[model samples]
Target: MRDILVFLIVFGSIPYILRNPVVGALMWVWISVMSPHTQGWGFATTFPFAYIIAVCTLASLVFTRQPRNLPTAAPVLALLAFTVWMNVTFPFSLYPEYAFPQYTRVMKIMLMTFVVAMVIKSKEDVRRLVWVLVISLGFYGVKGGIFTLRSGGGQRVWGPGATFIGDNNALALALIMVIPLMYYLQQTSTNKWVRRGLTASILLSALAALGSYSRGGLLAIVAMCGFMWLKSRKKLMVGSVLAAVGPALLLFMPQEWASRMDTIDNYQADASAMGRINAWYMAWNLARDRIFGGGFEIYEPATFAAYAPVPNDVHAAHSIYFQVLGEHGFGGLALYLLVGITTWRTAAWIVKNAPKAPGMQWAVEMATMMQTSLMGFAVGGSFLSLTYFDVPYYLMCALVATRVLVQANLPPPAPTMTRPG
Candidate 1:
């Protein structure tokens, strides 16, 4: 019965998992553990669905055939272990209550990273995962579209747990990240039905993003689309036309959606931009003073003290790069870059080498989406602290792991047989 329940949950959650790894992972995190912000209760309060899904996945993995290990797992594991060690040893001062949440977040990411490496062994698995993600995201987009039409499209409407749901910008960013992957899937899928489905999912997700009134999200999507277009001009033209027409016909949205175009302008004035420059200035001065860094998670009070005059509100540098530099110092920053660069380079290499291989294609798609997502995050991180979100970080690690796995599985280049004269 326990095994059956686990199977049911893993299969049931497949739809959501397909749509967005971030959402799926977050759901798992919420369920396996509890969060205080939502109801002051643990898993029972916020993540019932995720809890069930996670338990089932663990059970399924245990019961399934023994999984093969990848070669790159060692380095990735070492880095993660080092990161956790540094966090603990550095004695970064965060609220005691946050300790559990932080730990749980890390664990969830690790779990997802493992899943990405273990489960995505073949092209079929990749296709299944992509379809699931598309369908799930499409469902959300449809839901969001309905809500926008019903509410006359004002502020972004979140379902039950608004606490877990990110703001318009964040949601937009999340959806934007998926767009490239969807496009890649569409291009590679042989089955007409699969291609059609991916197309529909992309359109729906884009509409959902636009409806969210997240200027940042809109910008990110446009940027991703542009990048894809640059890669394939013919596809880009068709996509651009479809994108323009789809939102107009499907839902009644607000004109203010366009206002987000001016979002960059705020940075110019440096006043109403909400203290971004001040934060950057403060971060620089803090870095200068503490050449080694304040410690992981130590950005709040320790660094804030230097900023003076106003009360020191405990906040992160709003950028992952800066956050790493400020908290973990130069060494930590180097590791972060090493992990990122290694994963990225490996993914790119696989894509370039195995253009025709389905697994390779999927890897390319994942790599492209991740790279774009990272870019979006970097831009958005200039104003928001998105690193706390498990999606981007976990996906990056998972892709690296996947690259390692894929490379390890490839048969050694057949030894050129010497001509037997």
Candidate 2:
């Protein structure tokens, strides 16, 4: 019964965990887990997954058999507290409705960061969690891919009413960031069948990413692959040739894909793309004009009115840097960059030291993936507010925390003492 309960908690909740309130509740209690800020259609606009995670986090604190790992959690907690304080005291005004939702969004991210740090302690724990995420998302990807191919492939379907849903893009990014782990597992797994299965899963994920039709997602995959190539130049050159030729020979792609490629260049002439440029300029102007900001929600409508003749309001700058600049000015943007840089440096250190420990091979792989994901977001953020998604941000924090824990568990360097005769 206990095993059954655990299985149900982990597996049964995957589909609805991000959007449903009931499953989300289960997730918080070690019964389940999900990304709170996934872009999808569901029962709620923002999804109740974060609240569920918070609940489960509290439950873990109260009832888990293992003692709380405060050392691993301290940095995460401090960061969360600071973010909340900054949000509340930043002296920016926003529409009450918008501000309230934004507050919850920030809180959700903080909760995930805290829970992942506390919950994932060992190498095995990290592997298990990664597999769970991959399996759940892989199932969806396969299904979506089949449907897309059969129906002559158009916009991807999420749940009901999920128009413009970017969950597919989100899932793609998550899978790509785990590529190093997939490679490591393939190399290290004792079970041949398991290795084969993981390889198939990786391929399916890559295809699904292509099917999502998100230029940003494609850019991320390219950047990640480029990083891998840079890490191994000889292999990269051989692999690049094979990759370039393989797709042409194997697949007959739709014309829509060609159109999508054309759209990338459309930024030069397209009105919508031009509007983003205008928005950036307007954001800079607003930052200079206001002491703190013109107010959080005010920029979108105002900028649209000022720049676009059509009066199309924008809720966000669609770029994290511009959003920060518009909402919190130079000071807030500085702090945000500081947090991101600190997290990246910490993850890099783990990767640098990974070759020393046998068990750290997986950590090194995960760290590389994390770094790639960070770079993707850093670049993608120039054009989109990718930070609004919780999964990547929380995963980055988890990696940092995991690295710290791994280092702590390492035996102390031989103590040196000098005795005077």
Candidate 3:
């Protein structure tokens, strides 16, 4: 029955998608990110629903008469440049067979980002996309948080298989990134019950991240909240509440969790930490010697032997910074970093220049939460390999789109971030 239902939804949406490409794009996101079929105990688990939808959506785009509305923003330009660089490095890739498939996957994600940038033309479109995105990831956040509460954080919180947040560390980072989006939903919701539900979801998501026992996640939440307050117009109030809530959540976690995070202070003794450092060095050396880096599956013993001092101790590039550096080289890493930095500054500009009137409140709040989410991703991502994850890229699409929506009613671009007077 579950399989039938998912199949029906995917099949049913094709005509609508052909009629309205934007709807098709949204449906694609729902299937890709949330992966509802993965939850069911049926044939839907094996169904290639996203593939079918993508085919239909592309057909719709090509055959339909709808105008393609890609926005020109710094973030979007950086993304395009980065995508071009990835393509340029493909032939140079040491492991072309392995790298090409991963390249195709990233290409699909980039396609969706452009589809979103072109399709989402209004503030309401941005809001709806936010809702779908939040629901896609927040479902995991809410479930993980409840699991933590029920099990007393005894076990780890994992994500659906073959998905972005498949492991505990990735799950934690994904949940932390969703925290601000959850807050944005709560703030914009006028319904008391809806707001209350969002509040519970936020708490659960935080608990779930804690339950994942990811030390990087612990650091991320701190940096996320700090940025949340720092960027807010009402920083003092948010800071006070954060200060009170931080300790309470810490005290609620199990002793084992605390012990695990404590290894951050004694990283020299932690095997995992030392391995990550070794991998970082290996990536650095590979990029130094080979401009395009090793491409996909660069952690093999042969590649490591060429660049690593401790070749036998090779591990995957655990850090996003190193992940791109090793897979695509310094040029690729620079383009990747520019996308994030531009998105961050673009979000800042939106927040500052958003209209002062009541009708534009959504734009202000949207920009704030995006900045907070980027803060979580930027800081925590240093320790994780989610450089090509669609979540941040999707969120960046929304931010650039939001800037367009907001700027329609405003005079000009806001001044860049300024130091204290």
lDDT value, candidate 2, whole model: 0.57
Q: Could you say which candidate leads in TM-score?
A: 3
Measured with C-alpha atoms, the lDDT of residue 362 in candidate 1 is: 58
Against the true structure, whose lDDT is highest? Answer: 3
- lDDT by residue (219-300, candidate 2, tens digit) is 7777876776565436767387549743742263467865775677677776656666667766677677665654455555
Per-model TM-score, in order, reads 0.72, 0.76, 0.94
Instruction: Give candidate 3 regions above 4 Å deviation.
Output: 356-358, 411-421
Model 1, global lDDT: 0.55
Pairs in steric clash, model 1: 18-132, 18-133, 19-132, 19-133, 31-51, 34-42, 34-43, 295-327
Q: Poorest 10 consecutive residues of model 1 by lDDT?
A: 31-40
In model 3, the number of clashes is 0
Off by over 4 Å in 2: 1-53, 63-65, 69-78, 89-91, 151-175, 178-181, 232-251, 294-299, 306-315, 409-421
Clashes of 1: 8
- Colliding residue pairs in candidate 2: 28-56, 29-56, 318-385
Question: What alpha-carbon RMSD in Å does predicted model 1 have with respect to the real structure?
Answer: 6.3
